[model samples]
Target: MTPVLSRRALNRATLARQMLLERKDISVLDAVSHLVGMQAQTPHTWYLGLASRLSGFEPSQASTLLENGDLVRVVLMRGTIHLVSPSDAAGLRPLVQPILDRDLQNNTMHSKPLKGVDLARLADMGRRLLAEKALTAKQLGAELETHFPDSSPASLAYGVRNLLPLMQVPPRGLWGRSGPIAHSVLSASGSLSLDEMVLRYLAAFGPASVMDAQKWCGLTRLGEVFSRLRPDLVVFQDESGRELFDLPEAPRPSEEVPAPPRFLYDFDNVALSHADRSRVLTKEFYEQVRPRKNFAPQVVLVDGFSAAEWDVEDEVLSVRAYGKLSRADRAAVKSEAEVVLGVYGVRKVVFV
Candidate 1:
């Protein structure tokens, strides 16, 4: 019988591995790679994700890394923009190409009208155009229309985007700055296999179900990959009898382990990576914390589960709890809020 693990145990294990249980002193580049990548669809908000996990993290440090090409923002895993190291962009992007490929075929924006369009020709032309100069989606589409005049510019641009793995260029994701979200081709090699991808996911966010891995990457049919890796992994069962996979030596802390208060940025991976988020959020708070209406909730995690919704407005960090918190948990949350608000240079903290 696979050892059954409780939700609290899973929560602590996740926090320990995610570097949320304690701030890690690793470099920004190292942390980015360690987490596989940080969801970065939002321009500047993702920086807060790193700040909360790393010791002495500064916005300028990550901004400088982006400027110097040490880190890049690109569409990967689940076909969303992620802030990843250049190496991850190379190794992981090619593996998730199927997701992009399917998007080109099935997405309403391109599929119907582009029915017989020579995608190979389209991809080649797009690459050549990007090779000449980085361009935003609008700019690239307008140019693509010059050759394929019959196709709508939007359709042509959408095709190129799905067919080509374009890296969003710098100055766009830099801290306290905004620039055009433009695309340039990635030149790095080293495409990893599906098994490697699964292993990487397990290393970073494991003791997870196969469904969890599939949900995280937006790719399907990975049961074979996990099955092949089973012998080498440490397996367990959750209360629901679903099997979970983890690295053999990965830390599985006791349920009673200390979990400090954490303020999570919108779309933080710890909240989004797992299909069964019961480990990090209760059913009652799920709808409140889930991304909706183009907004990702900023949440307060107390004792490894989301306990409140939080936001900053007019330089005041405000938190609203789901229910009454214990005296100790309340104090821990306020203490962490102070540190977070200080980092953002906010002058006030309020609990409403």
Candidate 2:
């Protein structure tokens, strides 16, 4: 019989692997590789995600890396922008191409406009245009429209986005720097298979289910992948009898282990990566935090579970409890907030 792992057990183990139990003294490049890349559609907010996990993390350090091309923002897992190392961008983007293909094909607005268009030609044109100079999606689309005037420039741009590997150039993602979000062709080369994605997901957010892995990557039919990897993975059952898989040597700490208060960025993978988020949130809190479709609240974790939502304005961090925190929990939240504020060079934390 597969032993049942309780929710708290799952929570502790996940926090340990995610570096929430203790901040890691690792470099930003290594951290990006380990987490498999962060959901980074929003520029500066994502840097806070790294700072929360890595000890002595500095925004300038990450900015410098991005400037040097050691790190880049590209479309990867879930067909969303992620800040990843160039090597990961190379390996992972190729694997998720099918998702982008499906997105472009099924988009109601884009599909009809793009029908009868030679996407191969458009992709070629996109590559050439980007090679000459980095351009925003709008700019790239406008140029392509000159060659295919009848097609929707928006559709043309969407086709280019799906077909070509483009990297968002610097100054766009740099801290305190701004520019038109622009794309240039990515020259990195590598490939990642679905089986490899499963293993990496387990390493980062494990003792997780097929549904969890599927949810994280926005890919379906992964049961077969898990089956093939069963020989190499440790298996257990969650309290509800859902089968969970993890790397054999990965950490599974006791339920009683401490998980201190930490602020999480909106759409942090730890909160969104699991189909069953009971490890990180209660059903009530999950619904409250994710009150609407596509809404993920910036949150504060108390005792390894989300307890409050947070916001920042002009560098003042504000945390609002979902219900109410006990006096001790509130103190813990404020104390961590103070440290986080200082990390960002902010001066105040306001609890509401």
The C-alpha RMSD in Å for every predicted model, in order, reads 1.6, 1.5
- Tens digit per residue, CA lDDT, model 1, 116-164: 7899999999999999999988999899889888888889888887787
lDDT of 2 at 274: 94
Model 1 Cα displacement at 349 (Å)? 0.9
Please provide TM-scores, in order, for all candidate models, with all chains considered together: 0.96, 0.96
TM-score of 2: 0.96
Output the worst ten-in-a-row residue range by lDDT, candidate 2.
Answer: 282-291
Q: Write the per-residue lDDT of candidate 2 for residues 1-352, one digit (tens) a residue.
A: 8989999999999999888999999999988888999999887888888878988888899999999999999988889899998888999887788898899899898999999999889999999999999999899989999999999888898899889888899898898786788999899877778898889889899989999998888888999999999999999999999999999999999999889998899878899889998899866575573567877688889999988888878888888888778999988888888776565666777888
TM-score of 1: 0.96
- The parts of candidate 1 lying over 4 Å away from their true place are 287-294
> Cα deviation of 29 in candidate 2 (Å)?
0.9
